[model samples]
Target: MLLNHNQSSLSFHSELYSFVPEDHILRRVHDLVDFSFINDLVKESYCVYYGRPANEPELLFRLLFLQFLYNLSDERVIEDSQYNLAYKWFLGLNPEDSLPDSSQLSRFRVHRLGANRVEKVLEHIVKQCVEKGLIQSKALIIDSTHTLANAAKGKPLDVLKKAANRLLKGVKKQYSSLYKKLPMFPKLEGADEEKAKQLLQYLVELRNLLEDKLPDAEGSLLEKINTVKQIIEDERLLTNKGIASAVDPDARFGRKSNSRTFYGFKNHIAMTEEEIITAIHVTPGNEDDGKQLQTLVNKTREQQITIDEVFADTAYSRKENLTFLQTDEIKASIPLNPAVYGTREDDKFQYDKENDEVICPAGHTSIRKAKTGRTGTGTNPCLTFYFDTNICKQCPFKDGCYNNTKEKTYSISIKSEEHIHQMAYLDSDEYLQRKGLRSNIEHKNAELKNAHRMTRAKYRGQFGMRIQAFLTAFVVNVKRMIKLEMAHSE
Candidate 1:
């Protein structure tokens, strides 16, 4: 039955206007996330204490969560929330209320929930997952991707020299015009006009020197001088770009495909079998995955979670990483680079597992000669092998075996005793299952890049980028937790 016109002016506060009504997904998020946990982890003292006192502590936090969940910049979030009904409903905001201004959000981010606070939030979520038995910490997949910084390309020396010359000429003309207007301008009491003249003269001299020497300077010295000259002439220092991020110094330039390069910091995450992130590290974009493996493993250990196996690619297959993982009883299922195995010159080369030797195609056995050791790189001892020179000299496969004039020597580095064992396990069904689990971490990366819009950070500088990364990770964990809770309830 349709209601009569205007419903006879008998409208009450209908449930229709009560957006979300505790049944929406966002409402479910409010239920799954223990606000007390976030409060405990992120201290109130860090936030703005003097702002309009609000009884709802969740207001500030929800704003941050919205940034990550939607991957919107601070300004964009405020703009959208002010006009968007869905956003207001999602954030538990009433229709009458508008979002906080961009400055307020920025201040809140910089002061209250900074990078450290965001990390604590992420840790708390991980802790919740751990307690819920949703994270199987025994197996982990570790990887890193480069993030580009917001720095600009440096200017050329010739351009700087030309610009400096133009500026010096203009300054001279301006000084002449001012002096003409006031005949005693130079004589003004306590006036540093002389100092200004001296500085200008020095600048002119310096510009002349630069113009003369720029063509002769070689290597990085030339680059350094040119950069300085550009800064002086342009009144602007060199930066990757104006976008300051707070994460790492060595932001790397990375290519995701044939044409796109991501400029920022590398985000390293170790995901467990249950697809929960066990550990996360925001490092310089240039940091290698192999170098970070041990540190991440240690961090996982710090959480009181034992990492029994690590799945990664060839990049983390360095000897040092393997040795460290082995000592910690962590199995690393890193794929071997086919190049490392070397190609068989002839079909006769066979590897011997029992005697730890290699049999040459010419029927000559290559025996272990000396155990060479490498420090700093890894604790693994490299076993050197040499074929009998007498046998090699007359062998039918001599040409194929010996590239050098001397006796043929073949060396293989055994990083761990467990390498052979793990290699065997890598072929087993259990290892395959772990590999399957490892593939899921890429989905998390995709979510960050595609869904969360983390591919290019809006902020510039290491610290800013770190804060952004932490917030993004925190949002991901919250979303996962909320989904898990909903599934459990169902």
Candidate 2:
């Protein structure tokens, strides 16, 4: 069973070979990258000389890859491998080969190819594309997308109390002695629910009592109780933990600008200038997008891809990110946040950095210039300009721009010189070209959500979400490399 002995060879009577066209994407994917790398990546996860053999690791992983490649669920992919000739050809199955049950794919993913190997397998496939000249990697386009969590946003107070009590009863078999002495949690129902405040306080107390009594308890039990305790502490309405899924408590409430909000995870991606995704990372929903640029940059270097420029939207325009990219000698094409620049209109004043002074709107220059070194925490200080308000009071624009100041000479601070210099290219033709390329990542995000089934996670928990992202990106790269190859041929 482990050896996959049902493979078919060239035959005069068979039409399987002619069924698929030469221009098919799967054929291109198969011929482009070697699947042999999977066997090496997952060999240690399997039993070498075992009792009743198991599904071959390579075939199983290929089936999972097929699911991601075409956006099929586990059942659909297995069904396709059984009846679809193109799928059969891709899986190297004989005409009468039996499809494994759908349950097998789930078990293999959770048990066989855990998070580590899943990541490494993706990297190995990327290396193949690099050798074939499909990915240039000279520039990286960065962005993030949200995936909704499987759990509900809020559970009623009574509902949560019952759920928690049920979990405690289920665990009683392991700690019979400890369970008997534990305090019975108060069960509050009905209109007293608005006393949800009291309910939270009670849960926190119960959690502390349980931990104090069972000091040496398994970490998992402690974690469940702790999750409930933290939920009580974080939310006034007492929605599960800060996470939406109690079972998958790692997912968080992610904020996307001021308009959209969802409970789930965020996928941060770094794509090559050619549009192939080179790296991806998953973070809690509420995490800041600005924090992951350095991490994505690090992943590219680990794969030996040199990143000469990184372009991102305003969400990733924090000072630290700009400084890091600058220190690394990679061009940081981040736009300035509106908060960084005050009420200065376009061409309101021209700044001469070499002379260390600014000309006001009325055509008079500032009286003095001041600057400070980097803070102990390492962020660049804003450059402050001192304006003589006595002169400003006589100017036409003073009523609109300078009324907020107290000094006869008003002082204004703007973001660092480096940030201003980097943002100066906002109007260049070259900048617009590159920015257009950055927006193309939105199409890729759509493809993942629409074509690859990333809209809602198929499995629960953070690691499961990561597996889904990695495999989806791998399949996408395979398809893209083929398209690029075909276009070149044409």
| Cα shift from native, residue 369, model 1 (Å) | 6.9
- Top candidate on lDDT is 2
Query: What are the per-model numbers of colliding residue pairs?
Result: 31, 2
Worst 10 residues of 2 by lDDT: 236-245
Candidate 2, residues 114-224, lDDT tens digits: the string is: 777787866887788788887865988899998887666555465356446744774576788877776676665556555555666666776777777767766557657
Judged by whole-model lDDT over C-alpha atoms, candidate 2 comes out at: 0.74
What C-alpha lDDT values do all the predictions have?
A: 0.61, 0.74
Please give the lDDT score at residue 336 for candidate 2: 68
Candidate 2: misplaced stretches above 4 Å? 1-17, 155-166, 172-185, 189-241, 344-411, 425-429
